[model samples]
Target: MDGTVDITMPAELEGTRAVVRSWLKSVGETVRRDEPLVELETDKVTTEVPAPADGVLLEILLERDAEAEPGALLGRLGARAAEPAAPTAEPEVCSRQSAAPAPPALEQVREHRLSPAVRRAVGQHGVDISVIRGTGRDGRITRADVDALVAARASAPASGSRIVPHDRMRRLIADNMLASVTTAPHVTAVFEADFSAIIAHRAKHKAAYERDGVSLTYTAYIVAACVAAMRAVPVINSRWHADHLEIFEDVNIGIGTALGDKGLVVPIVHRAQELSLQAIAARLHDLTARARSGQLKAADMKDGSFTISNHGVSGSLVATPIIIQQPQSAILGVGKLEKRVVVREVGGVDTIQIRPMAFVSLTIDHRVVDGHQTNAWLTAFVQALESFGD
Candidate 1:
């Protein structure tokens, strides 16, 4: 006796919604247990759902581009050599399965990966897409992929003009950015932070941290500073609701990791308030490596309460209004770390000094917090960095 295994959408989707991006295995195709059976795309990330058991794909409940709620049935896998009964689930999808539903058309499945942005660009520009090669994920076309072609056609193109587009990811990121700026009243407050103490601490412990397999990153210190700031202004670690404010006790910090020209992903270091400096560094190292290699899971990008954008790594001195991630009240932006001339009081005497410093800014949703709270948070954050013990 053999029973069908249910394959369903993941219950803990970041946004509680997903679209069936593609069916990796067709109905009637034999698959191994744990094999990737389908792909689902949420606004946060795209993830592959695996087969529940070794069996033949007996039915597809959700076709490509169909919306799915958490735990909605995606398909059914029947035990090999046993024909399962017509699944009582979503019978409407049965039409896709006739007596012998044909596998998805090769071109249709591939073309579906092109985002509406790409489609619109193709129509708007009237460029022959066939001649241009795709540089996006899996070699799919992207708006950036299309733009480079148009730029090449121009009479004179500037240096470093091409941008890499990773199709769906880029499109979703753009939409979220547009919505955030439109919905939230953004206000940014800038401050200068002295990292002299942190630099000294790292220099002393870097070798020891390396021995323990941790990189002892500056980000670890930044995260610790953020937690300290959260204590000073708890509202910084909160979300805005129409009726009230929802402040969280846990400081889940999302570190914005850039992937060269492919944009960035924010992987949260959950409950940062409880993590030690070494532990924070370790997690950042792992999450960042995985992010760049395309190995991060959907869960890695979920449930962020606050975010930190270390934009300084790319050489920018500062970026104002680094758009706040929606729902979250604020985002901390760290600019390029460079030594500069400054005035310091030493033994009650003020004198000129050269110190390593970085410009930091807190971009907040004015509806959620006021300047007093924003400035208070930045002051606390800088104090944490400057007051690091020798």
Candidate 2:
């Protein structure tokens, strides 16, 4: 007298397929209709999948941190009554986990909660789970935990065969790279900017800025410059839609942050055009810290007008960064700041002096923008940084 209900993937998120970040309901747990059963996450968003009907969870079709496609069966819901199947309803059946599924080895079981990234890393690296010690909150396993185990084993000259599995993020990153390369015809433009004025400005006011409880950084300077440039050349803040182009009026900048081995996340600084330099610095600090902590919300990744990846933070001289290919036209990258000597006209005479400078690279969808517009945006950005006063 039991009937099965299927949980189908939502349509709007077809391109943005979901991954099981966490499973809230387990087998045999009775769930209410529309109750959240699992958490799904993409690179840009995370959301919950609701129950198909009021029933008991019979089986989880996928494991935690597994990839799910749109319209794919997430899990099975079993009802006590053999209710008549409604028209246009799809029958849910559990797919074979493997042709010959076997229970996992005892060593495969973990004693502590492992975050999705850690779990995926362990699977990919084929690390022995028994030796990993969790250092995260509540002794939860982290990516560092897995890496430490791998390093220790490697240093010990350990000899053991293991099969690892790639986590959902790695898989997603792979698919994303493929889709982006295939979909977007990318073009890049590089230019160097003099940061003498901005550096002097920071040196002159950084202490007072800190006194106001704000950390003054070159990032704030870049954000301010980007805001001015976007205002002057709005086309750089646009998106390409089929048959037409869509331009965003407000400027929200997405900052690419590397969370070490955990992975990369871009937390958007909302309404950046409306904030002062100090305010932008404060918010950038907050968003980046949260992003590194894996605490960013789904809404934080939504609606970015443009993106900035400060690759120079890691000492890169320059990088042709890949675009996030969102509802945006372009992404800008800032390289390492280094002191270089350049000629300047001083007192109507040529002079050679050292100045802190950086290379800026902009990657845009060339189909929507041209070289002139791209360079113009970069020119305005450089001008703003050079002209800002303390």
Worst 10 residues of 2 by lDDT: 133-142
Clashing pairs in 2: 123-164, 123-165
Tens digits of lDDT, candidate 1, 322-378: 999887999999999999999999999999999999999999999999999999999
TM-scores of all models? 0.78, 0.70
lDDT of 2 at 353: 91
Compare the candidates by TM-score and give the number of the best one: 1
Q: Candidate 2: deviation at residue 19, Å?
A: 1.3
Off by over 4 Å in 2: 1-16, 22-25, 28-39, 44-139, 142-165
Candidate 2 residue 116 C-alpha distance from true site, Å? 15
TM-score, cand. 1: 0.78
Compute the lDDT for candidate 2: 0.76
Output candidate 2 Cα RMSD. 11.8
